[model samples]
Target: MAYNCIVLVKQVPDTANISGKTMKDDGTVNRAALPAIFNPEDLNALEMALRVREQHGGQVTVLTMGPPRAAEVLREALYRGADRVILLSDRKFAGSDTLATSYALKCAVERTGDYDLVFCGRQAIDGDTAQVGPQVAEKLGLPQITYAESIQALQGSEIVVQRAFPLGKETVKCTVPCLLTVVSSANRPRPPSARRMIAYKLAATSLECPALLKQWPEFETAEALDRYLAERDQKIPVWTAADIGADEEKLGLPGSPTKVLKIDYVVLETSESRQVPATPEGASGLVRELIQDHIV
Candidate 1:
């Protein structure tokens, strides 16, 4: 049997470094100040799905929900060996929390049709809610396994996976058509293949406008684009909300029930003191002062 796997991924803002100017007065993230990268754990999930396809003859499709710029990650996925890629981008999807996000993703999955397995990262850096996978599974009525570290075995329609728990790990066997959330320990993502990079450098997805073709006459016709995409066999196919039969109300911001109540700046108190020494005695004195001031 030919297995089909779908991997859900996301692009998240780098939250480690936050500047005073990074937030708008309205409390929304100042996206301009933050660099965007694929959620690191999601790449681990993608690696796991790719390994499954390598072991079992099957195709791997990558799906992501983000803005038009999110297509960059889809291209990156192609370079990593995904057979196909889909971008679920729509204005309505903006400001959606996990609940609304999952709804949109489930609709996209339904539109994709036939698939035996679905994979997603344990959590996103931006939200860290880790609710989308389970929510999608609930919507699709599929069995869900979260925090999976590895695939212990796969026999026919049943798959044995090593799932990570707070206390330890457990192996669970589930049938096909199941959803799995993978932790970073699941697998290490491979670097993009040099050969594929050169070939699919300009592959077009549906999210791309016809204007791109006009701007670059080389990909003017579908036939020309096809030839170019075939050269590397690493191009990601794009899809629109309509292509996926997504419910208008259930997509984008209008369909979302969650809202960002408030955003505020957190400032930490600082002191100007010169350390007398770098020795343990100096450290002890600093610790004493911190304890006295309740700043430790």
Candidate 2:
């Protein structure tokens, strides 16, 4: 049987490439110093969804909730064979913690509807809570399998997956209309297709289409440019909180209970370090010194 799948993806700060004034005294990340990239585990989730589509004959729809500039990841998804892409963007959705974020995502998923499966990364590096996917499942009233390493089998309405744990792994059976949180070990995500990359390099979301036309003027009207984009299947829909029917009270900062109390950086000083010989007397003396300094 053919199945429709939704893959939840995110564009996260490339922590590895972070540079220039990367930290503050309060311990908050300097987001401006980091370049954004597709979240690593989310790519695994996308790969899992695409693999399912290849096995069952279905389409993979990719969705992300972020600012309009996040369309960069959507275009990347298109290049990676996402049949449909949606961006949930709005200024009001800013400063959302996991609760608010999941609420918005649940609403967006409900708006899109008709999915046999939903896939998401186990956790986002920035948050590292691993809470969003399960929270979304609870909101949607669906069963969720987290830390899934692989989909073992699929039979009509039922599916089986292997969950990975720190020490070992276990298998699980669940019904469809369920969610799976993909782990990095799940599978290596495929690279974006070169042909699709070339074709969709200019793909634009609703917010970007008008500017593209204004900058190039090859298309006279928004309608004409939209038609042009539609013809090539390069138009990505951008939706606001209202578009997904999210309650204003339950979105953005208003819905978030968790607040960053402070950010701190711990610095170790090599100048404060002392070398001790690997001898009984040296170890005993070190311990004595530690005891004397009340550092034991």
Winning model by TM-score = 2
Estimate, for each residue in 149-252, the C-alpha lDDT of model 2 and write its tens digit: 99999989999999999999999999998999999999999999999999787799768877788787878888888888888777899889889989999998
lDDT values for all models: 0.83, 0.90
lDDT value for model 2 = 0.90
| Runs of candidate 2 exceeding 4 Å displacement | 18-30, 210-227, 265-271, 274-296
Candidate 1 per-residue lDDT over residues 156-184, each given as its tens digit: 89999999877999999999889999998
Instruction: Locate the minimum summed-lDDT window of 10 residues in model 2.
Output: 18-27
Model 2 steric clash total = 3
